[model samples]
Target: MDESLSHNDEAHASSSHSGSRRGGWITFPFITGALVGLTLAAGGWLSNLIVFLIEEFHVKSIDAAQIANVVNGSSSFFPIIGAIVADSLFGSFSVISISSCISLLGIIVLALTAMLNSLRPQPCVVGSELCQPTSTLQDAVLYTGIALASIGLGGTRYTLATMGANQFDKPKNQASFFNWYFFTLYSTTAVALTVIVYIEDNAGWRWGFGLCVLTNIIGLAVFLSGTRFYNIDKPQGSPFVGLARVAVAAFQKRKLQLSSESKDYYDGHDGVKEGIVTGTLSNSFRFLNRAAQKIEGDIRSDGSIAKPWRLSTMQQVEDFKTIIRILPLWSTTIFLSTPLGVQSSMIVLQALSMDRHIGPHFKMPSGSVIVIVLLSTAISLTLIDRFLCPVWQKLTGRSPTPLQRIGLGHVLNVLSMALSALVESKRLKLAKANHLQPVVPMLALWLFPQLVLAGIGEAFHFPGQVALYYQEFPVSLRSTSTAMISLVIGIAFYLSTGVINLVQRVTGWLPNDINNGKLDNVYWMLVVVGVLNFGYYLVCAKLYKYRNVKGADVNSGSADSEK
Candidate 1:
């Protein structure tokens, strides 16, 4: 559980695991292969969910968009809980295995809904006054399937990423595994968007949902096959408990004078002398130093604290401080993700109304439009690693720090919003000209430019945020660190859902038929949001200091700038 002894633990694990010849590069294929299957299943159903709801459930377009956002929010949000459970109750392997089976059951339920007409409402003809509304019973059936699927998908994704990283000891090997992990994630989602969505659009919904079910089964199978080879970490109590204890102890001893001498503080267990390894207590967040300041009766005749809530180790207080310092930077990411959440649903609606033809005979599915973002991100990731980072290093004499990379992403995110507004303005004008038609005269491809920009922005920010959190967070919260991005994204999606509801109530910008509404105004609104967020991000980046500063790390220069 000690951060300083992580390498020693890994070394111990390696020697013990080596006897059985388990847990190294040997488990890589199975994990990555499982990630592929799981991601495919998730994207196949989730990506196409809005269309499915509107087409089969007799839900209104705007209502379906709201539902999609909510589902996406839940899917993003649940991973943190999954990570916590993995870290506190069960190991990653058990959590993933159980979650995968849950996902498979959920997908099977979804497939059943598509296959059985009785489970869904009567299909409504578009723009028809005689269409039947979905009954409460029908709605319940659909929601049950969605809730199950969302919970299942949420539990697996990031926990799987953490599990994959745990398989190796070397940072270099761990880094390589992450590269392949993300590549598989994006690439498999792309496959789902194109292949599975095409089947739903062309063949039958039943077939597409059935495919998801198959992939879920295969993913579970592949993951379970690798059980003998994983380096599973057992639960070491709740990390959050330590943080909470720091806050409680600080409050309880608020009246106590702060300590100046090193011996006054509790240096963790093992009876190691004070100031030997931990040095002195941090000066920042000085009020919290009371938590570590020893008082009579706080410690037993032995070294450990008698009342855990009244006193904490110096390391615990420092870990709590680390979270507080990084929070401002983390807040900036919610706004970054919020605009994309709104944009995602809006773009799908735009694609549904516009011309979707590809020359002679092919017509693109509305959901498949998101594949543009995925493909662009994957390509941009390659370009950033191969060309942009090197060019940046040459130009600046140092590699870009995580903050710098995230800053670039903010700029690009703002630009993407502006482009989205402009493209929507054009689409709206064309929609007015063809108001009587089912589809607008404009090509759906017109929306591609904005989507590609958003994708490029993600390529910069997503990994940057991941790296920043992983490097900056307390080692005890490693699983939680990766899930923090998901937490940001989840909140963003939920915020977007709230924003959409507010817009619906207040303005005519996002009507059921966007052809008659001012969706451009919505994009323009997001443009403003992005600009404000980017400014806030700049302020946070300016004031932020990197905690982890190895000589060869990209962040070392930025850390030095703080001096």
Candidate 2:
């Protein structure tokens, strides 16, 4: 196989997929990437599983955020580094391999800390009357464990996904490949969430955390197993450099060119899912990065012009300007984010209180609801997307685009949140009526609509936006572009927490007490979140620009790389 032919052969390949399965050695990358992704999720789940324990040990929410930030940041950090090393020294495959190892070590250490915690004398929970709280010691150990886990998880998350994307070429197969890529990502998450959460819920915290270690080992094994047939990327400088250079030029208001790569460079765009029209400047985020001088650069041959691409339309420039201007509106989705987020927080509280009954003799485990996560998501997507969507297409004469899917999800999100709030409201009324506990058996069932809605919502929302990002952003900013899109969810997570707290404070829902008092107000609050999320969706719908930029379509045949 002529090495140069790597370009010509793949140049024609679609960004979406390739039929070439690595029958021999190539399986290494595939298995490695998937394992990394699953392991990362498993590790993050462990952190969630034991977060209350940390709080029990008196670990403050600030400390918990530090630990979580480490894990979450990995999703962004590694790819930027990997993209650099990949374009410069080690390829994406190598970066992924290295990241997996790093993350594995982190999980191992975290597991060890858990073992130590089980043996240590834990501190008492704050505000205790008679009972001693063990949260202090638990908090110390969790802090250490989560710290290491975060670095590892963050590095792994970024490397694996970027590497996975590197596996496929673009243009012809771009769409289909993304569909499968997205399918696997969510499916893998669904599977991990279901099985792992149960262990955390039932098997004890130590084993639950240890499971991430198992996943890491599995991922390493899979990467090793597949050695041949992987599509390798040509090494370049840090993607950050390209982004930086492009950004500076965009603002100085100049024409854009590769300026870095010669014949050796190939343009790759990850946002193949965004359905923006060709020749349109609809990538608002990328444009902002340019103006900010962070993610600016040209996807063309080496040049000295030192200016950003002077896109023809000021309207397009304004489109980006418009989107950035409207970011605060999208930011409002954080409120809806708050309700959905209680899954690990208040929802878990509810889950614990539920009648853990499953079989005739066996009690349902606390974490068992996670099993429902995947099961419900798969069923709904297949039923709604595959069956219902096609029927709708026949009726409306159009297939559901990513945007349409988003709209549907927003609608579902409203309903899901409302259902949760209603259940909480009922729990309050039932408490008042019967002088009973605030946590109801029916609340567990009520969560069904919410969780199922979330899964369905993600299936459409994240993947759709990811597809859009790749299709629209300049090739240089592709990986970073996707990361930013992903960052929104994280931002939403933080914002949601704040909003929930604020509402609870204003309504006096905190310190939920002995009977059915404190939590009922909490339920009504979530109801409001659902309504607001629907409105945010509407706002985004009105302002978003739709553009589809193909790799080949945007390709400027210029040569600059000397190496």
Candidate 3:
């Protein structure tokens, strides 16, 4: 018997050793490079979509802006479903691989549309009655490409972030990976905005979209090449199923008397105590504790639960409670992001109406101006990681908490909107003085400060939100946790469209021609919304207590102190 057990142990140990050797930092470069290529491809097409629709498809500028917002929303929204699919069915590697293929196909179709003259409407001459509308076939082809590309990009983006973090064991290592991940994402996106948008403007849409297709294929190829080195986690049953089971079990056991003894509740398969309460049930969400209450026939002779709906493991119960606790804080971020979405889409219009000339030789594409936000985010992330964080730790003897970082983001976001309002007010004054010409005397560079501030706010809050969710979420739901930020951004973009439509219907704040409208009022309204949202966030953060205070302390040194 001893010899048999020793042989089994040796085999298990050898398998683990092989897996460790095959994965880890050795695969980092390949994954990062794949991400760079993917970002370049996605950004190349998406950044100039509004311009393409207006110039080639003969869509009105405001209509094109709405389409772009919807596309952005869909791209963000589908990731939640993708994360669920990754965690529940396919796993990250399979999902990413499949999504990449789909993206490549979509980009190819999009490139064809750009290259084939019959696939689009006649080129619209600006300020001419000779412009042609798109055919039914052209519309069908364009929408198909948009849908496929959105779905594909959605599936792979945040899922890759989760997969990359899975390669690291330490929380610090995971945090560092997120910083670099966003840095790479923003940097590559900046390149696409400048280079690809320039190509689309100067060389034609065919060459630009062709570049997107080439990069997407390269990204897919690089990802597949690293397959042997990836630490692929197999999909367990859906975590959502486990959470639902907890709720059902609690409801079923509602009439049963509560037990004070620790042993009366199911601990887990190993019979080891694990949760915020350690041995006893946590007092916060007392009703959920009933899910783990041991009753007659709840346990079988083999030590498993006889009735799954009558009893659950303590870990399962706690996981559900953690999600419930974080929801209020999560909600505040939605309002925080809504204004940003509105600002980004509106800025393109603002740039179109303003002087975009940098020199006598060149005029900037409106899409390229948004790269200011990406560049600012990338540079700010580097400075924060290398300099600000270390200096903060030295002076304060602790790193900043996620809540603090998010709070600072809120303040900065409000300031960005306020600055935008002032800038627009000045632009409107200039437009009125210049007799509402197609281009105002004010330079597009005047729009940079607000975008830069918004970018800096993203640098602080985006990674902070990801880290907070990853650290706090249940192990089974970690992938979904990372995708939650994407979900918020998605919903916010949609809501921004609703807000704009409502404003357009009720007031003249957002006419098709922004120069004839009160654009400053819209920015001022966002400032008000941001300030109110920040207050709500403060209340939520203050009332909240960390479930994993020890882990939080190790990560930030100030999480417990804040409580």
**How close to the true structure is residue 355 of candidate 1, measured as C-alpha lDDT?**
91
| Top candidate, metric TM-score | 1
Whole-model lDDT per candidate = 0.84, 0.51, 0.83
lDDT (Cα, tens digit) per residue for candidate 2, span 177-286? 34454456555665565566556656765687678788777777676556445555657655455434434446564432323222222112321223432233334444
> In candidate 1, what are the lDDT values of residues 104-203, reduced to their tens digit?
8888888988998888777666667567777787777788888888999999999888888787766656666777787788889999999999999889
Give the residue spans of candidate 2 off by over 4 A.
Answer: 1-25, 28-37, 40-91, 117-119, 123-140, 170-184, 225-229, 234-303, 306-338, 430-443, 475-481, 512-520, 526-533, 536-540, 543-545, 549-563
Q: Which of candidates 2 and 3 is the stronger one according to lDDT?
A: 3
As a whole number from 0 to 100, the lDDT of residue 55 in candidate 1 is 86
- Sort every candidate by TM-score, greatest first: 1, 3, 2
Q: List model 3 lDDT by residue over 186-240, tens digit each.
A: 7788899999999988899999999999999899889888876676777876788
TM-score of every prediction relative to native: 0.93, 0.71, 0.91
In candidate 1, list every pair of residues with a backbone clash: none
Top-lDDT structure, candidate number: 1
| Candidate 3 worst ten-residue window by lDDT | 554-563
